[model samples]
Target chain A: MVNTSGNVLVVDDDKLICNLLQDVLMRNNVSTMTALNGEEALSIINSSHSIDMVLTDVNMPGMTGLTLMQRIKGISPDLPVVVMTGFGTEQIAVKALLAGAYNFCRKPFDINEITTIVKKGLDLRRNSMREKEVIPFLKVQLHFEIPSDIGFVRSIVNHIQRECGRLGFPEDVFLMRVKLALDEALANAIKHGNKNDFSKAVGIKAEISTKKITIEITDQGSGFDISRVPDPLDPKNLLVEGGRGLLLMGLYMDSLEFNENGTKVKMTKNAQS
Target chain B: MEITTRENVEISIVALNGELDNESAELLRENVEQLINEGKVNIILNFENLSYSNSAGLRELIALYKLANSKGGDLKLCCLQAQIEDLFSFTNLKKIFSIYQDENEAIASF
Candidate 1:
């Protein structure tokens, strides 16, 4: 097995299971930290920097694994989380996978099986990180004149999705989140940032670092006050369908910032650590 | 993607062809939703021409099936290609939907 050289957070309420997993992981040269509940795990994650994987039990006393997954996604969207369940329900496994789990392992798992999965997860993370590093900087510039209508937004999203998928990203949550974030950001650039101006075009550039992915969208129309944008969670905007796009972008992206012009937005997501 | 719809007796058959990736999956969802909205409940998806489907397509199909079931109707599938059949098997969707060997059997069952 390949050594990831990073720590693993094993979260479970059961002390015995935690110790057993720790031992198993240690025997394979994997460093591990144990947390009895989600609260502790979150605290550990916040304090630490090099946690590469999280092996969590689905059912826990407080803050179940699924809830923990959501919180972790909010914090580190690229972190690989493997869920282990004793109940072994297909529906629960499927839901966990859909919610961004790397894989699900049933209780009473074979030691070899867990080891193999862990190796595979680590390899996947390494490969993806390498791909992010190798993503070439935007070289050629292409101008696209898109109407400020909804159809234009859909077409742009479709093209982006196809291009991203063709670039070798897996058809999974990572790609989905990128697609969702781009859709919302591009829509904002067109509708709110550019104010649906047909004369001006949006300039898009993608930059990839060894540890992060950044996308910039700039509109050529009049800008708006970034601080004036209303929060979607506010009760006043509950009935609106458009305000949620910004909220979704914030949730999915690691960092979002606006330039002085206020018509340009840059979104970044760090690759798995 | 190619979509062909046929109505026979009490069932509507929508045949899907080509790859059902993220781009084409939304169109499939809209097509099924439109049929359900038109009060055509008993529907069969003929997959003889479908070559590949990823998770997005599967999710759309599941959503449509649930919508049909909630409306006191059923969604059956027929003539699934080998690659598409493997997807159903891997996801265990074969157990969820009524699968038939051909369109005639599916329509007759409906």
Candidate 2:
């Protein structure tokens, strides 16, 4: 077997799941250690060789997955933790995401999908470690040029969420809000700015600093006149399905700005108060 | 997604026991459309087990509401978890749909 040199801790109550994941991860070139529950996982994490990441289950008998995540955060704050949950357990997934999970997968998950997520977590950790050596403060710039695809947009958001968690940002204040604003902005860029044209591209740029986080999204169409846009709050427009996205962006971010052409939008949110 | 539909005192209570996401929103749309086409439009979507939803799911809900209203029927929701309620509130969707605390209250409201 190839040695990927990435050590992963796999925590699950089910022996079958542990075995399945261990087999899958190992064949993919990564080594793994298995734990039955949160306590067991923490014990391994606290007193073992370096673990590059964690793969955990959300629902356990004694120490829950979320509690395990929190405890893992306490031990190794920057290590990415990927939570695994059963299908239809969306609530648990949401809680896990909010609790700073690097990512999550549904039960009976595909080997390829799990391996890809693990690899991404490993890459993020690698880049973070490198950045720590070079950058003095939290000055991170992530730029992507993607087609107007929802799946790509979601992946970008997930990565940024993990970055925010790693930076120790207040999860309650920023994680969900940032996700919402990004969704709205990206949707608008795709639907309105590019008119859903597959050939057109959307540019996403994110910057994080000690006191401010700024995100800029630019689309490839002629801009609209802000003054001509309907006021969604007006009684006549209350029931309209559209136009709420911009409002949501305005609400969630500390400041919102549009370029002179209005094709590019910028949103800035301040650090925790 | 697990969708359980049953009739309770002339009101159709549809229990959604999964995440409402882009993958499942189309299914939800189809299910509700089937109910509306059958004239079982006065509905209550029971969200006791629902945990998360994305923008695509929200779009489906808005379309479902519009369809129900145009058909001379109404759609109410019940047992929303805190995050789901906050989502509706955030979008001001609470103004369009009547939300109840439980199935009985939602049925009574209609």
Candidate 3:
């Protein structure tokens, strides 16, 4: 185990519990701060990136600990989070662990065991920091397959929105344009290519980084001739509903292309560009 | 999508809230269909609360406009969110739709 001095932010509604944990951690030479609720804890986490770990209770008034942890992960994903729960709420703690909490401890816990867990989590975070420093780029990739139903496309777009937000894409027109382009592409793949057949499926893959995002969408059906698509912008075709998707895709993406078969499309957008 | 409707004399003002995407296009279509079926032709679609939209939504809007126009009652739009306005401008639909900054202007033009 890497025996390094670490900082922990302890979040709980009870003042006495905060004081007790602060006292125990101070004696063990681990620096700590106390937050009365999840909101206060998030304020502290956002202002300082120096916090190595978070020890939070499951239930809080304003924002639940689970939500706070997810928000914290969005901001600094490598930071370790440890959840605490009372005896009856052990299930919540287990759910937290499954959702990426480093570990969970029940209430009225032994101080020694909690201290060891915090120390180990901090060490793992420190090691991750070292690895990130040596790495050239951090890429987040997501892949999804869905039936050829327009109803399911919204969830995929929402997933892309979250990933783009986590990757630091601005919450402005650019983000909306990216989402609109994806929605249009997915609709075309489902409605036109796959013919909305339940047996056919659409595949979507997105690779996001701090620099750029690349999205590829594929369908199971045979493709069409790109030249045959009417230009929606033409005065005669302005009222046409079907051709706008192709035009919008060409306008929104930094670069867009299709495979020779036209069954797949790849779009790239540069971050902050 | 949620549609909140109010009647301004003969004009029906329909305010749309939430996303106007592929999933919710049918809801808007059915709502507009009912409005047209009732012979309420002078309509102003208030887009101030619409958070998002896509081409599918755009298609429905075009179809709705045609339906309203065929009945000799025109469809006007007002209070479009910035991104939706951008979409209109990008597609040059701004020329086709009579858009106003507020409901009063859209109503006065009718």
Candidate 4:
């Protein structure tokens, strides 16, 4: 017996075909698991972590190959699947391929073609797993400079909020929380930092990645001590409206910081997913 | 923000139809002040049409709330958008304001 090269799950309603494919794959030094129907195939897939690829017959008694492939995708999105169809079922094989099967082959079986397709699928699976380990998720960065006037702040905040959506913030509630944080930071920059001076400008930078988002806002005015910002949640300060903005900023963001002079504020929020 | 006031006897229902940001907060404050000056102190701010608000707008609301209380009446809120309601929660003002699900409920509170 040859050492196993890869593990492939073969599914078909016909017992003869299942054994034949298993025999062929076994001869190719590939380990094979045979399931007589889609349900059995799913059972194997759920229980076995070693399934690298699926080789399924298009027309099955229970769930068709297309349905099984979709189910497999739901279970393991990147796991490669190959579909097999008998003669005159070319259309079903094509449909399976379109539905995200790695490849399809018509039967009465070409041994070489079957082995080649199976090998390729296993290679792709191995490569994909390796890629995932090394590849970093995409990051989005944005920067804007505008007059310290409050007029431009809203549009900039809106633009950043939209980018948050693109960065996969799944909830509107989370997006709003981000918006509120930005609003408070910008208002602090314009109103207190620049003292509402139209001649001054605010510098904004935002970085959005898969794991977290960071926003930095800088104004041309003197900065203040973050420790001095009153706790709005305090019972005595509950009715005091002035300090609530900073409190909101602190609460909404995972991290909030200010420069030594108090001109710049940075806020970050981790992705909730 | 466009604030449209409807007098329900001694109570005033003020509907805000735009964002209640910094500039618009002043507009809302002025409009609500007009209602207060006219002895319509029990105000129900209908935020059904209001889409967005920040700290500036919230400060204005706090001012309005205090003014109504000082005048021996109450300021209530109703139909706040999800984000605005969240703002109230984050600022710890949700507990201070009389929030209602709808205009009728706010009116009934008074």
Question: Pick by TM-score: which candidate is best?
Answer: 3
Residue A63, candidate 2: Cα error in Å is 12
Sort by TM-score, best first.
3, 2, 4, 1
**Full-model lDDT for every candidate:** 0.76, 0.83, 0.88, 0.85
Tens-digit lDDT track of model 4 for A75-128: 987889999888998888778878899999888889899998998888888887
Please state the Cα-based DockQ of model 3 relative to the true two-chain complex. 0.68
* TM-score, model 4 to reference: 0.62
Q: For residues A150-194, what per-residue lDDT tens digits would candidate 3 score against the true structure? A: 988878888888877765666563456688889999999999999
Q: What is the TM-score of each candidate against the true structure?
A: 0.42, 0.63, 0.74, 0.62
Of candidates 4 and 1, the better by DockQ:
4
Interface RMSD of 1: 10.7
For candidate 2, what is the lDDT? 0.83
- What lDDT score goes with residue A84 in model 1? 91
- Where does candidate 3 clash, by residue pair? none
Better DockQ candidate (2, 3): 3
**Candidate 2 chain A — worst ten consecutive residues by lDDT sum?**
A167-176
lDDT tens readout by residue for model 2, A175-223 = 5566777877887888789988888999999987655679999999888
Per-prediction backbone clash count = 0, 0, 0, 4
- After superposition, the stretches of candidate 1 with alpha carbons farther than 4 Å from their true spots are A134-154, A157-273, B1-110
Model 2 bad stretches (over 4 Å): A1-136, B1-9, B17-24, B49-56
